[model samples]
Target: MTVNFNARPLTKALIFRIQKQNMHYSNSKYWDFCAPVAGILLTLSFAPFDYSWLALAAMAFLFAAWRGCSAKRAALRGYLFGLGAFGSGVSWVYISMHDFGGAGALESSLLTAVFAAFWALFPALAGYLSVKMKGPGQVILTPVIWMLVEYLRGYWVLNGFPWLQLAYSQLETPLAGYIPVLGAYGAGFIAALTASIAVEICRGKKRLLLITALTILWGTGALLRNQTWTHEIGQPIRVSMIQGNIAQDQKWRPENKINTLLKYKRMTEEHWDSNVIIWPETAIPAYLDQVQDAFLAPLANDAKLHNTDLIISVPVQETAPVKNFNAVITLGKEQGMYRKTHLLPFGEYLPLQPLSGFVLDLINIRLGNFTPGTATQPLLKAGGYPFITLICYEDVFGDLSVRGLPDAAFLVNVTNDGWFGDSIEPHQHMQMARMRAIETGRFLLRSTNTGMTGIVSSKGEIVGQAPLFQETALTGTINPMGGMTPYARWGDRPVIGLMVVLLLGLLGYGKVNVGRISVTAV
Candidate 1:
């Protein structure tokens, strides 16, 4: 009898099942490689590279890796991916810590690792919840959980580090049209949902349905791109954004302070013909009380003569024990002030004040102690236009940036990005500033210390920009917009509510007894 050497059907079926299982929750060593690769893809999807489509691919890979995974294995996979994403995407943190904050290399690396790991827990939580809530709707539930966690991550810990959010990558894409309607969380929801559906298509589960859904979802965004939500209330005004490019090391030195003041003065004097001339954060580099007479008074007089409004960043002294404020003060026809409300943790002040002494001993930085301004502060007036102000790190918080609302005519973001050196931080900062303009439906006038000084339209387009590390001025015209986008009116409340509803609907649909989404390995 001739024996057939081909494998039996039963054997082939078992092999196929094993392969599918491995794609979901593999005990194989290859997962270590796959997870990190997926993470790097995610990192590349943001700011510098802006390969936004890769974000969907990254999420698909991650979702596949997480499928059928025990909570523990899923957490590990998620953590590894986070390591890859933040390790590369936020490597500038190390630059800030070691290069500028006077920290040792090992210390900075360890601190950065801890920071990345902490954020990794959010994605890990999403994975755990997805598996525990597994059912026919697991794909839909996964993205909802992803968006919820992202929203929480924006404000829950240490006043939040809302950088590299998935939706931010889509700002250049048609999907960004969702921002004005549903805010960043809404764009994130669609992005995550698209990613999950892509995973389903890859598994051959719902190819036609998933493709159609994606087409409709993305096509709607393309259609909404041309929709006008806000309109110009006033004519475009000439704005001059001066980039002094002052060295971070010399900015605080008493000797170099005079030269710094003189440099900004000379630059502003040259641009006096402009309607509004602005300076970067802490441009004065001295107490407001000290500079008001010598520096500010003279500048204000010159501004009055030229019919120009001058907005400059300076530290304002308050009552005792409250600490000083990072503030922007205006001098001209329309005079007002705005203090920074969303202060950066560690950069602006230590979060856990009990350990402040111990933490300060290890790493040192300038202007590390700052008091947050009141949330209801009035918008600063520049050249008879009301402008919302965002100092340095303040623009990262989108919801907070629009506090002034319909009352504010435009946005002014003054940042001293010289600390990060010739790194990606400035570029990333500018991107967030643009998003703020989109969220509020107002033009953004950004003035930075080293570069990225420019005018951004309400539509999130860069109208004009100065070169990085250049000591020059970006001169342009931007209209003062009056109307508010839905995001400005509602903030993230609607999106957050929708996420909660979806999650509850998923749990209610399956009657699955999900006691707790814990990190337990199989």
Candidate 2:
């Protein structure tokens, strides 16, 4: 008698045991403990750490935690994950609130917590919706839902905070190739999709198909990197960026104001041979009307004498409604003024009226009450070429950065990162600025107060950078670029519209399939 040893049943039993074990753990306290740790892992994927690959693993961990869970449980896990991510990632808010906003350490901590918790709700909503929309095509549905919620968080709520976006973390990866074609949000969707597929593969679902899909997605991105989206239009021009390294607390002091002006002026005079010179945000530390004649006129004359354009940032007090604008003005060889359109909600202006006022007053945190500038303002000219100007926080918005593109030859961002002190905020800010360069295929000349002043190439690589916390002149040459990247042409609309359609299609398909199965069973 020949005994046939059937190994298929034994293999099936082993696989079933493993899956059951996974399900039990996923529904237990283990997932709750793992959620926040996964968030920290996500934070580590960003600047100052830059473990980009960890981003995939981090999201996979969160997805696993959400799998086989109810919507409420998933939301809780997501909220915990967000608390960990934002708490560690943007704790620099504490530095700004305590060090600059005049809030006590304890008060700053509480306010910072509140800020993180509030933003965490976006992820919670994503988790809740993901579970509600779960179906046979959940691998695709989960990532689409996640990115849609990220869009709401980054563009809509409270004037938007686009920081800590997953796309920014993938700047060094092949996924960055997607930026020019799809912009930041689209790239983020790809990243989220990659992570979602990875989670499903681990669950032993459509392993071969998911693997092939990932290979195609990543391979296509790698190929896209070699494609030229924008080209140089003019000769390389010498540019100088002066980092004033001005202390936030002392910047507005009456006595230090003159020294600040003189410091930047002295630095500019040294680099006058350059085609263009840039000063960081509010480098003048005073209203434009106050210094137009006494300081700016002579400086403009000197810049003209040296055959260079001087681009500087100063607060402009406008009359009609007595509104104050954070403005950038170009002088010397060219003349133009671009007022900042996007304002940092709490930092530049308060929202929610009396309620926000009362809360801020309770913390004794008095912020600027500046008004936003018009969006249709003309582009500023420097080095005899038109350029887009992003004042401080404006560069974080990818859509905002591309508004003047194709026409604008390069990008100039004037920022004062000193408010966050010697923290990761400057590094993160510089990282996002580099993404803008890649998205628009324009050289980005980023001038910052107190750190990370640098010239970013169209490929998102650093051409030249200054040491953090140093007062020095960073000199680099950039060729003015003229051409339209797909992102520059259509902005985020195409990607957003595509996401919305995919979500709706998946929901419709799932319903139809469910209906057919129910009728057949009956």
Candidate 3:
């Protein structure tokens, strides 16, 4: 068949323009497909990459994808974005599950996908509810809902994997200034709100108003960044953080136990001149009761003789319930103990007792059957300095980490990141520790097995750091500081209160706006 263009000139031009416009519209429809890339951008905005501004751009893309989309479509878009975000960011989970847990390659990949997919539901819910609930004021309401989901992600899960929270990316950004006053959740809310404004700017909506709001938000952060929220209460104390660099595969073997104990002992003996020395979590591979007579008692005597204090992590047993605790204890100065309260599901304890055997067989690590500790534990002390003691991943909980508050002078986090091997988990873990310092206005002395042993200042700066995967000790002088940051005194109550008020106000305004539009239409 031969096609002929015999139309008049004006009519042909109109048809061509219509076709061009339709083609442009067709091309624009694929923006929603960009959600995966948006997720990558979001992931890179955090720890290892440190390109923080990409977070805003990523969220802007998400907002555009979700705009005018149905709830189901929005959920799909959000899920894809999450797969990209958590799939890449928390990819270290696979290392822990496979490299350390003895899972086969296929099993590890599937497990990681499931974990990421489970958490993806939070953002999916956020997207669905944002469209469902935001009757008129979608921009502001969307981010508020997003923050609500972020809060739930840290609260309602099996304990919580509160990693890669939006505020964490801003630890070096001016937005971190809001942490002392509002806490990380509050800062995250602001970060998400800023991203929402960026989306509006992209859509060419309320440019002047959004610009002014952003200026005030960032300017306030800039002003607050230099303000000191906590003060030094005593002289600087010399501290040593010992990194044993024990491989995960070798740590728990019966034959390697004695040698591991001797290695830590030798390192401790060398560091006794320091005022305080810390050993990483489960650095003793055995229960405190088992090691007390053979190991700890002798170490205690040596520490006292040298006028030094030692804090060590061990498993502690309780007789009545036959439960075990992932605990830290001190010797020679302030004798106190801190048991880990926030436990990791499956890794620390099985979700249900019936499936424990099967779960262990599949995961293949010697998972701990730990009982959660009470929150009213005493503040641990070392070398006359009261300390907020955190074990392993517990420092990820900002509110829990600061519970000891103004009473505790500084913070100490002891971890064993050998489980994740030479992966990004250690780097991200260190980043979270720095944020904890910023939130509480206290220096953090972190000791880890196989990396990130360092001292972080109250301002979230890593003042001293040891090389990763090394068997070395990091020594530094840390001042015992007093006075509560606004976050420590009030906790996250103010931020939660503000969120409640804002959500209610937005819902009311949306109702009023819908009513007015309805009346105008009639």
Candidate 4:
């Protein structure tokens, strides 16, 4: 009798059962939706308040269901977890759209849900594959599979967002040392492994000593990177960052332009001793060339007179008909500019223009039809030192923000978080910024429009931090240096490659073992 394994009805029946089970738990029409939502809510415990580690706990529960449950059910659970995590994590996007974008509540909420659902697929696929994949332990290749999926989601989607990864929550932990080596992706792997190992131990697996010893490997991370990434190769440069705390509604208005400039000038003047005075993303409401040359001339003159570099955020117009963004423009240090490359969808420019505007306007900011900048390359040096520059939201992506480092003396992140307003968004924003410093072997100088602006060292230590919603001038001197970390030079390739190899090994082992079982039965 000829048998077709591909036609096996067992898998189909299992998947149907899983779909039904998931549908019963979730209110959504989609199957397995509950898992993603549960995962997201579970991750909240991992945030700053009290139960952040609970994020890992939540991940563990999902991992089991993925490894042992029906593949279809596992996939559904993964997507559900993603929905919950991103639904809450990126809720800030809705604020930007509804309150600022002019998109009404209902429309913005629906779009946010759609956005969350799209990203949730990353986890859903990872979960589904974990079942198809066999590993040494239950989901032993979990970290590899997770990272592969995250990398795909972050890159495959429109400009992709790698926000709210489990690694971001552990910015302060000793395991963070792995960030520079493997980038944030490596941290995710380690964090996931720890959680999975814990789950196995909890399930009465007698591998305590082995797992305990393996976790101890993180000690190497703490020891090697206990100190700062780079030493002061150059004298400290003084910088004054102005936080205007402007309301998002009035920010793009023509009438608020003068008030915005005056507010920043006031805060900036307070730190005349500063050698470098900076502003946040699009600090100037007008385009780069549109603002009176007189406006830029003085800042340039002041930069030269003070022998300092004054960087301001403004949109720049290009002959290409694209309005490029510097977000922060350096004055005095003429030619001092680091243009933003990665653009924000809907917020910066509409993705699909034909019907995109209608969809974007629903979110409501005018989006200015801004053009994307040409190069996200590096800092525009002045006063004899190289500084890396990353605009708002740019720092959240570990790869983009930390690139061109090691060559540069320090890093600069300019952001406008006023759109979020008094939400956990700012705190989390600051938290993610700190992780970038840890990832790159350099100091970071943040000049934000609203607050949480300050200096963070290579060790991810917050040397100086500004309070949220306060209009203030933060002046500090950050030591600039040139040093390299394993992460700075190699990027995520090594960690990801390790993961891929591991997954292959698991698959091979499973295939061989299953063959042996079949043979023995015959």
Among all candidates shown, the one with the greatest TM-score: 2
Runs with alpha carbons beyond 4 Å of true place in candidate 1: 1-25, 363-367, 512-522
Q: Write the per-residue lDDT of candidate 1 for residues 300-386, one digit (tens) a residue.
A: 988999999998889988776657889898998877778788888878887787575576675654436788889888777886777
Tens-place lDDT per residue, model 4, 379-433, is 6774467677788877877777656666678788888888877666777777788
Off by over 4 Å in 3: 1-29, 352-366, 516-522
What CA root-mean-square deviation does each model show from the true structure? Answer: 7.2, 5.7, 7.9, 4.8
How do the residues 1-522 of candidate 2 rate in per-residue lDDT, one tens digit apiece?
A: 333344556655864686586777767998898888888888899998999998899898888888877799899999999998999999999999999999999999998999999988887888999988876688989999999999999999889898888999999988989999999999999999999999989979889999999999999999988889999898999999999988899999999988888898889889988999999998887899999999999989998898999999999997887989899999998988988888998899998889989999998999998988888988889898999999998899998888877799999999999999888899899999999999999999999888889999999999899999988999989999999999989899999999999999999997665444322221
Clash tally, candidates in order: 0, 0, 0, 21
Flag the better candidate by lDDT, 2 or 4: 2
Candidate 2 local distance difference test against the native: 0.90
- Over 1-522, each residue of candidate 3 has an lDDT whose tens digit, in order, gives 443433455554864686576555433547657877788888898877899998888887787677765677778888888888888888988998888888889888888898888888877888887767755567788888888888888866777778778888888888988988888888998899898888888779999999999999999998889899999988999999999999998899999999999999999998888999999999998889999998898889989999999999999998976989999999885677888998888788887566755856766656778998999988888988788988888888888778877788999999988988877788888988888898899999999999989999999899999998889999989888888888888887778778878888989986655443322221
lDDT on C-alpha atoms for all candidate structures:
0.83, 0.90, 0.84, 0.73
In model 1, how large is the Cα lDDT of residue 361?
Answer: 74
Candidate 2 Cα misplacement greater than 4 A, ranges: 1-23, 518-522
Candidate 4: residue 326 Cα off by (Å) = 4.0
Between the candidate structures 2 and 4, which one is better when assessed by TM-score?
2
**Better lDDT candidate (1, 4):** 1
